[model samples]
Target: MTDPELPKLVLPGEYLGAAEQFLPGRGTYEDGGRIYASLLGVPAIDPADRTVRVEPRNAVPEVREGDLVYARVDELKTAMAVCTVLSTVASRRQVPGAPEGTVHISKAKDGYTESLAGEFAIGDVLVARVLQAHPGIKLTTAPASLGVVAARCQVCHALLTLGEKEAVCPRCGHREHRKFAKGPLPSPSGAHGPGGV
Candidate 1:
């Protein structure tokens, strides 16, 4: 019976389909008692039941059409600003190599979003959406639940929020220009599916 403590299952990324469990150690996978697989880019591990689970890894990036995405501002223009994609979903940490995306001022919000400084800033994390993909992808954030998740103060490392036309830190009352949201933001693309997720 192989003792009950001889490392029951394996990891998700280490599985390849075979008799019994085939997931390698530390691969991370999903588990369903009979079969284990990966869930939400990560492997499903009880980390308690000690099971093996894994699934076919999706090769595409996780870009949902109209999904809010946390972005980092790089350059700003008179009306618009060029930016780099930071994260697709809101989490403690961000995914690596998710591809750089953009967010136009017009698509920043539905109302008069004022200057780009009032809405976003350099290295600011913003929640935007994917407006267009043809001739390059165009981004926008006019949704209420699809905005900033967390903004930092320019002076202190306190959390900030959108007050009037700027970000105000609630901790030290330090007003800083940054994007933030209540929770995890949406993806900066209009393609939601099993492709690049």
Candidate 2:
């Protein structure tokens, strides 16, 4: 049978063909008698065996436990801080889907965390370690090396500068407490650089 017309490139879960017409192959899955693309790639059907497959164009970066990652705090709850994982620190690649990660108050710092608002503010960029990668992403900023790497003043929204014991906003002169990561900010270019901020 001749191959059916298919999109040049397909996204994950895009319908491809009927399972009866094309055998499910690599990067394709069969479900309810239908074939679907399993990744971002070009879809094709093998004429000889009638196998449908998607040739991956780019590899998706996987997040794993113990990996260092950069994330932005989106919301602060009583017991946890919700964040969107931005990228993997080592690879410096943006995480696909922008998975949500949470930092429990107990893992916010080394000791007791009186309030999530005290340590993290909305839009604060954090450098945290992945404590759990599956089921749901769990993060930890308790280590001195892992915490808010960049934060803005809550009052004026000016970028805060590192100070003796807290972050200071030059514009508003507002001082805020944070569990700062013990290193310099990652370069705007997404590369790691030296010198503490």
Candidate 3:
């Protein structure tokens, strides 16, 4: 007679009901004839299939279509720029090691994204909408709520005010252009505690 035990897959943590595999990485498990997150990885859970969850290893952050994400500008153009996704705000420890994404100027604000400097610079962080995702995230700042989070003087790196028409550095009087938000946006550099939003 042979013994039958539970379908033990190689990974850790209890079954998160069900899970999905985004990429292949260390400490993963297979359950119900499928793979899922088994460690600190993308926030994926299946409701129907009860399986162990796991995570994959990569380099950059992954950006999905229609996801609100935080990103920093690596480079910019007259109409577009490349962005490195800083992290996922809505979910916990979202995908680890995805890839860098792109932010188009046409989508930089709600009204007219007439100029790139009107919203961002080489180092400004942005809260943006993911309009589409190719190899990289197609980003949008078209929402009134989405745009530059912090303003720095391009010349002197002084902190600037989130003004009605644009961001101005009080110390240097350097004016930065941007599509206006009603008031200042909540700080993006604020620290997030464990399981914090």
Candidate 4:
């Protein structure tokens, strides 16, 4: 007899095999006497269990309230900074769907924030805690461990190194004040600075 068919890529609604031969698993559905792919993925056949499943490619995790996240400042406003969440700290997976998050000036630091411009700048990457994920994602950097982890020099566009009260650019010697997080900061080599996160 000929060799059995190998698993192959499949699109939604593509027929997989007869339902009697293989039970439908994740990313698959059973219709009539046939199993079909329900998502864009590769069809996996389990000969032992006689099951068929479609493993989706690049499955990203969704954000949730209370999750720590890494985000880049997209826009700075008078009262808030609009940030696009890059990933969640726990899963390290790119946030799916609406990744836009907002951090009000009051939530930027623990004590108080005089102005949003004074505390944050566009393109700054920070660690934050998800305060709300309902109507829209709301973030807070009020904890000592949460705040600007990395930033670029506004004047020279070079990566800023962590300083006592702010970040300083080695290229331009430009010092910028930010609500820096407590503890260690991320370095250019992608490693944590002394005593930093």
Per-prediction TM-score to the true structure, in the order listed: 0.52, 0.67, 0.58, 0.69
lDDT, candidate 2, 1-197, per-residue tens: 22449988899999999988989999999999999999999898888888999998887777887778999999999999999999988889999999999999999988998999989999999998788899999998886667988899989999999664599899989989988888553433222234211
Ranking by TM-score: 4, 2, 3, 1
**Candidate 1 structure lDDT:** 0.54
TM-score of 1: 0.52
- Residue-wise C-alpha lDDT for candidate 1, range 1-197, written one tens digit per residue: 22343234334334323325443323443344233333323434335544434333444455545555566667777687676666555442454564567666776766776787776666566666666544455676566555555567777877666654467677888766443444433343434643222
What is each predicted model's overall lDDT from 0 to 1? 0.54, 0.86, 0.59, 0.80
**Which regions of candidate 4 are displaced past 4 Å?**
1-51, 54-59, 184-197
Candidate with better lDDT, 2 vs 4: 2
The alpha-carbon deviation from the true structure for residue 133 of candidate 1, after best TM-score superposition, in angstroms, is: 3.3
Using alpha carbons, what is the TM-score of model 4?
0.69
Candidates, ranked, lDDT? 2, 4, 3, 1
Tell me the spans in candidate 2 whose CA falls farther than 4 Å from its real position: 1-56, 184-197
Question: Count of backbone clashes for each model?
Answer: 27, 0, 14, 1
As a whole number from 0 to 100, the lDDT of residue 145 in candidate 1 is: 50
User: In candidate 3, what are the lDDT values of residues 89-142, reduced to their tens digit?
Assistant: 555344466457677776776556677865678777777667666756787666
Off by over 4 Å in 1: 1-55, 62-64, 90-98, 161-167, 176-197
What residue runs in model 3 are displaced by over 4 Å at the alpha carbon?
1-62, 92-95, 180-197
Q: lDDT tens string, model 4, 1-113?
A: 11156356778899888988888889999889988889988777777787788888665577777777899999998889999999988777788764899999989987778
In model 1, where is the ten-residue run with the lowest total lDDT? 33-42
In lDDT terms, how accurate is model 3? 0.59
